[model samples]
Target: MSRTLPALRVTALAACLLTGAVLTHPALAATRAAAPSPAQQKLDRLADQFYVARAKFDPLLYATANGDSRYDDQIGMAISPVVRAKQFAQYHDQLRQLHMIARAQLPEKARLNYDILEFEINSQLDLEHFPEHLLPLNHFENVPSVLANYASGTGSQPLTTPAQYRAYLSRLNQLPAWIDQAIVNMKEGIRVGVVQPKAIVMKMLPQFQQLRSSTPEASIFYTPIKNLPAQFSAKDKEELTAAYRQAVERIGPALDSLCQFLESDYMAAARASSGYGDLPNGAAWYKARIKNNTNLALTPQQVHELGLKEVARIQRQLAELGPKLGYTGPANQLPQWVAAQDKFKPFHTEQEVLDAYRKIYATVDAKLPNYFSLLPKARLDIQLEPELTRATASDHYTPVAADGSHPGVFWAVVNDPAKYSNVGMTSLLLHEGVPGHHLHAALLKELPLPDFRKFYTEHPSAAAYTEGWALYCETLGREFGFYDDPAPYYGHLNDELLRAVRLVVDTGMHAMGWSREKAVAYAMQVLGYSEARATNQIERYMVWPGQALAYKVGALKILELRAKAQKALGPKFSYPKFHAVVMGDGTLPLPILEAQVDKWIASQK
Candidate 1:
């Protein structure tokens, strides 16, 4: 998952107010003159305070990807015991303040804000019981891997100005200390019997090896110095380059040290079990992830059953398409056969793969206005992922800065293009680019809210909100006329079916104690996934737990809301307005999103 992209803030489309005779009516004029209620006034002040407090405490929250320069110099010690204690204190204080608010007395919008804040505070407090910092480094997401990417000059941390370069250099110098602390935390995790699976620990080895370059100039950290802005004075450029090279040299030992610790100390202690079910409080931890990721109260068993039914349903559909694709095999074998077809893998070179996706973007962009009344002002950029991580990386989207300073990127992993297919590229563009993450994220900044609402990039416990919207956008291809062809349309189904499989397989391994092999086999049988793909997907679920389930859960909720709105409005239903309601607010929990849709439905009548 490309979780690094900052949400873009586009210019809000102007809405014409209800004008003419209504404005002049004496009764309406008198109503408009009334002041806000006392509870509403207090709620407004609290909201402002809450937003400011978050920004002040967690500077890295916004500065990480949004190109917010305010916190550029501060490399927050997110794992430090002192920092954790302070954060917990803040959470407790905020919760106390939140409890004092008269939530019932406030307006609906303010009440929703209160609910979101209350949920966020309590969840943060709940999470404190687990020592997450102890088991921080994973193959999927960790500080070292992320820092390596940021240093490569292509990631969210911008290095355009000399000051920006210097700021990052300060952050760069913290690498050795950070690595030392991580080793200590890992040692603690091993002592507490909370280590990562050996399978994932081995995956981290290659990443550490990648970061340990022989020289400074050869390192990814030298990227900014190499591409220094032409406007810099010769003396300043020389000094900055030297400083950056020195920083990279210092970081090399840290990378090597961490790598050595993992190989020598951590690897032997790492557990063999793949699921969270084996650890102490592992079940409760997994459940917390389920709640946070889906933002719903569903039990793991319920989600598991839902996934099983969805997989069966999608498999039945695949059987229907099997004969159409000239396959007469049993339904169980159909996925393997479809995956082996030569027609799907047409691109021979990386450029060919890039060109195919570019064409898809062009086609989708042309027809977007037909379905959406509001579109992002920012355009999308298609790029290939960095070569080091490309093989294992998923095709993902990274949002441009909200100020439109940077363009939103749809990064496709292009290693071994022969194994990859163009069949799903169009659908991929729809989900990652147009109506999916790019459009959804880009429009967040244009909303009428405080900086916290637009720029608070940390609350992704609402994964369902973000991933679900993108997944839902995948279905729009059919309505927009891009997936009329069977191949592309099936691509859409394949993606959807994969998400459905995640709900089953994620809960299966973590909650039901299914072996990794069993889960992989099920995916290959049902989703037409190759062994490598299936294994990778299952392993992703193994390490991340419930994160993958967010897509299907969220998309289903959004789809349900759309269906309900359509039924309520009948022929009068406006798809554009419905979308506006969904994207109008920044990312939200499904229940709040449903309430928003219901409110819109009522207003329509």
Candidate 2:
């Protein structure tokens, strides 16, 4: 998953440059010079209103994540039924307000904005039908894990000043209520047969147990106090430390209580079945997820078939490459053979693993200008995934701070350096770092887009565009000369194949009623993943249904658009220009993206 942050500083020169680019950019600059119509003005007002209103429900997410400090002392009760109901009602109201606007009369940019806002409002309304709040605690994403990241002083939550520290302490004070609410929701889920899978509940137990330290000093929440700025007065430092300790003490029991409930009552009620199809209204729910994530009206059966075809297509490429690497075996067995290679496991230390990624970064960074005309102003940094979440987290990109306090982070999960395979390092960095997420996301922020468009919290509905673009970036390895070697190229294919496999397995589990074991076995067989890797990936899909499908679904659409542009423009085609057309609008749904590309193609002709 990726996050977006506000721009650090818009220098006069930078602003002028942005203005010039927008005016000249083929995809963005409207041909008409007409002033805003009544509908356009109304649309802009509604967009601003929607952005501000949406922030109220999750001020911590909207403010802290975007570098706004106004809500620093607050963590809104998103899990509360009353709060959710209000938000749900707001979604309906927003949709109605959007409908009141005459979209056709609006300018092109305003119309696009209106369409996107409409899409978002409707997506939220569709999701509102499902009781997702009831089953909020999962192994992959839950409140405890999010709070731990903030308390660690390394995440979005800033802990620099006394006020920031107190703000976090205030948030800590509210932890018990949130946990209590989660329990209430989970119990209701149990009553309604919307409980999580037993395996996921078992996985979550350890995460909660990790939060129960004997003393506040030993807890992850104590990190801010330990790292307090030297500029702080002795009194301030001492006072802050005491407060954090007390806050931790209060928080520990809430965690313990939640864990105990999970172990005792929730565990007994957790469903043995894996798929959402097993739950009430689960089939329709899964279909909605498919539409949300893919942004294409694809059926589960359609996505599954697409995955099968992609698997075969990529496997043929892999089989051809395997022979070049002296592995003349079946395509399915190539991954196992590659994994066993000693050369691929050369790193013996964590630093060695990180250094390898950095080396790939340097190599890719130099070639970026050749393929992209629009690059992010924010720098990208590579780091190891934090210890608490490393076990379950995959390599991911964290956005840069809005105030430029933090650079974009590509967290490489190095559980064991010796076991870390170097085969996928280049492709992974491309996807999570430059020319992928960091490049796509940071550039989007720098664009003159609305806050709603640029900084809305990443949702599954937008995954098709975001994840799709990142996945497509992985293929740029060939163009960058990073895949000159057969090893990295094979790794790229494997990664692509992984996404293709996700489409099959995710839909199979959620929509087709495949067992968890069945899905895991299928991934292991097709991807040559170890039992653990396969199980972990399958479990992630189980928790986040339809999310895994976005990568392939989005990537394929972009690829299709690119192919269409290339065919239509012929000799007029440019990689950088094509990329600008795809990314120039920030993140967009597939249909909108295609429309934008078609407009660009015609403009060129």
For each candidate, give its TM-score against the true structure. Answer: 0.91, 0.94
The list of candidate 1 runs beyond 4 A from truth reads 1-63, 66-69, 104-108, 456-458
Please give the lDDT score at residue 601 for candidate 2. Answer: 85
Q: Write the per-residue lDDT of candidate 2 for residues 1-605, one digit (tens) a residue.
A: 01112222332233323321222334233333467788888888888877777666776656566544566677778889999999988888888988999888876778789989998788778788888889878999876687788876666676777877888888888888899999999999999999999999999999999988988899887888889999999999999988889888988889999989999999999999999999999999899889988888889999999999999999999988998888977767999999888888998899998888888888887777677666677778888889999999888877666566566788899999988998898889989998888887676667667877776436567789989999999998988887889999999999999999998999999988899999999998889899999998999999999999999999989999988988898888888777767876778888888888888888889
Off by over 4 Å in 2: 1-38, 59-72
Best by lDDT: 2
Cα shift from native, residue 321, model 1 (Å): 1.8
lDDT score of model 1? 0.75
Q: So what's the TM-score on candidate 1?
A: 0.91
The worst-scoring run of ten residues by lDDT in candidate 2 lies at 1-10
lDDT of candidate 2 at residue 290, scale 0 to 100: 90
